[model samples]
Target chain A: MAETGTSAARSDAWGVWGGNPPRNRGRQPGELETDQLTIAGEQLPSRLILGTGGATSHAALEAAIRASGTGLVTVALRRLDPGAPSLLDVVERCGVRVLPNTAGCYTATEAVRLAHLAREAFDTAWVKLEVIGDEETLLPDAVELVTAAERLVEDGFTVLPYTTDDPIIAQRLADAGCAAVMPLGAPIGSGLGIRNPHNIALIRQKVTVPVILDAGIGTASDAALAMELGCDGVLLASAVTRAEHPARMAEAMRLAVDAGRLAHAAGRIPRRLYATASSPTGGLPW
Target chain B: MQLVVNAVTADVDDAATIADVVRDLAGIAEPRGVAVALNGAVVPKASWAETRPADGDTIDVLTAVQGG
Candidate 1:
């Protein structure tokens, strides 16, 4: 953890190779599934959470989400029109759980109001509470973030703050009683990929609740990297929705998330600056 | 001008405020995710109250889209 004030953008320099995720062998020699990622005390089935706001068309958005196979998806209460491609109809048909978001809010008061509104609209307390401090950066206002989290918790809302990967900020958000605290791998909508795996790893290690890596993902590799770093889940949208082939990309994301989780459990080798021999025992064995 | 209001256009006064522009063009009760831009530059969300529009300004006011 390098502490505060990190570079805003994280370019993908990480090395990764992909394969079908390893199967979890239970004690009885049967496969076990890692289901229901619990954040802030709420259990959700899908690791690949989708966003409902950005597709070119309603049908397109619905197709991408269905292809993604997401059990938990996000929708906002404010921007939703009761008419015009209504979310309720799509959400009903998709048959996935909903996690409403509080976007465009700059103050705790407004954020809190939106959470209640989302709860009323979707009948779910889970929310992605984003209280932005800077319009250019879209960074979470840590001060207002905690303030709003505290309020939401009091009202029994599952508050998830979209925050930077600052340990202090993470600590504060978790302490404020957020269901889970989501730290960006990089700036939202930048398509820059994960910038600081170290910071995200640190946040995961420190937080008692699940630490979800949300936003700034460009491809499946980024999602895998987050899982390998021990993040409980991933919240994504553009990586699939914006893809030339969203359905295929959605399936790819699902595999990547599973692969990353299995690899974490499989135990990774320590990283070294220089190449090391994997086997010193190899000496022309006949 | 074949203007686009919420991606659809209307014939309204060129000097309308952003609030007026949206209220007139959108016909929707509330304008959400509507980030106003003049041609390319993003107008601050806070400034929608005081900012006025002019003809040929090429306004691009987009709603808060969630996904890609």
Candidate 2:
């Protein structure tokens, strides 16, 4: 059932998504065994990485995280209100590996400074480097992001670069020693769902590290679609925690990722624009 | 006593809180959006009201970060 509703949703990019000329004759008999989720050198069980932001409130965020069953959670280190909800308390309660992000830095130097401070505070080199080129789409500045990733990697930080789903760019990040390459499915906050599944496929095909389908996931189906497309993981926030039923959506997303993983291993039939009858006919010899 | 806060080793009364240290710094006039860490661990925002600074304890005040 993983590809049942999933194909309908991901049909937008079919021309590109499934257009890859056959590489492997067919999947191996057993399920595809992907490398464990390890950033820098730490191992994580859950491939579906969830973000703890944009929720209605701290309470909602906490519930959604619990529902999602995510072992790695994203936290932003920034100036909060004098009496606003405390990030420390929230992250602590989530009890997940903290991934601090360099979300708004315009330049590599700024990103490095924040990465250092975050490393000092969180005591982890797992930093999400988001150097956006354009503010409107929140797209990654490939040039700046690559520059920052190089520096952070040199400094011993497991830089996770959030970038477009371009194979060449994703390969660059992997070569730069990024623990993982998070190629956005679309824009940062658009929630338009997976806009370019093929690009994500290409990124997955090239990168040796984890390839996370990040951003623009609008609903549970969208997350499932990513996994079915062969991505090792999914990174999203608004789709699950901001929906009318956040907890329900969180549960759905959790299942979606798992189901999709199994499906990818199961191997899907080659998709065709024209449907053909499955039953074999003997040319009506009778 | 004149003290250099967050810049150099400084001096203050025995019971001075982190707020007092930031406010008492020589040139730092504003103390908003600043998180104080006594020694290394962060002092909880709520506990800051009642917590007091001690001698020889390194106090680091970090500014607010703005990112989306």
Candidate 3:
């Protein structure tokens, strides 16, 4: 397939991988110029990845999706009527890419099976591999997650495994050929933002693959903090969908992600043991 | 013939295809955005008409739902 101008530019942003050179050929006028978030050789314009769950109404969900300006949105498969107002219809209407997730599966087999089903349903090879180990914590089972990631990678799916903040597991998933590794900030939907920022940073430092901070984001600050910690993206659901004003929160999260990305790129000042004056003392004293 | 669809037992014709089962369970002529699995394997859309559910076989019809 011939590469688009945008994708070619993205390939330039991230050097070519796996023997295929990054395509950098086209330039467009007046496009929103920003650093690219390349996942599986694809450039996603927005750093904020939105979730489709927990919206009180379809209107609210649609509004939030629009407000967020996210390039990717996550949806989970469940045993339900296919004729209903499926989330697929909504996301399709919005024109952003849909990422089907294996939300409730516990075993590698279950997650893999669901991923195939989602592939058939969504006609997309991308799967957010989530293997929940514990019911209470909703924590990812690292062992099963690696197994599933390996299997899906072999199956030619773009496997983005949802893993823990542990750097070892993060490395394992990347080694398993996952497109990206998503480490939870905290338990899913706990509103507990970035329980271990250091661990997330460690994972970022350890893996070459993109690190997406998934779950447990309470609000805009949490999303910002994730990006500031060098996360490629943020995957969250309840933080926006379950809020009293979801649309407003969606806009805030969008802005926060941009703000954090800019801040991280601009670089931060070093922590000081003593107070360092922002203004020059000699000039002020005179 | 009896079949368990989404864990609900339902009676259908002996040679019922996955498409038929989906339409029946959803109570709609056209079931949109639904994917089917017979037993433990997904039945692709192209094979839906050819694949028939046998007795004691489980059929799972899934669609996009609100989840994280």
The numbered model that scores best in DockQ is 3
Model 3's A-chain: what TM-score? 0.87
Index of the highest-TM-score prediction: 3
**What tens-digit string does per-residue lDDT give for candidate 1 at B1-68?**
33555444566665667667656555763454344555545556566667876665666544323432
* Model 1, runs deviating above 4 Å: A1-32, A79-83, A278-286, B1-68
Can you write out model 1's per-residue Cα lDDT over A1-286, one digit (the tens) per residue?
1112323341122111112223343432232254458665556666778877566666767776776767877876533232464555676688987777887889988788666655644557788998889899877888898899999888888787898899788988888888788999988767678999999999998988788899898899999999999998888887777777665577688878877887887899888999887777577767
Chain B TM-score for candidate 3:
0.89
Better of 1 and 3 by DockQ: 3
Give DockQ for candidates 1 onward, in order: 0.10, 0.13, 0.68
Binned by DockQ into CAPRI classes (incorrect, acceptable, medium, high), candidate 3 is medium
Q: What overall lDDT goes with each candidate model? A: 0.71, 0.72, 0.86
After superposition, which runs of candidate 2 have C-alpha atoms over 4 Å from their true positions? A1-36, A279-286, B1-68
Query: Candidate 2, after superposition: displacement of residue A130 in Å?
Result: 0.7
What would the per-residue lDDT of candidate 3 be over residues A25-144, giving only the tens digit for each residue? Answer: 343332324577899999997888898889877778877887787889998998986445767667877788989999999999999999999998888999999999989999999999
Candidate that scores best on lDDT = 3
**Model with the higher TM-score, candidate 1 or 3:** 3
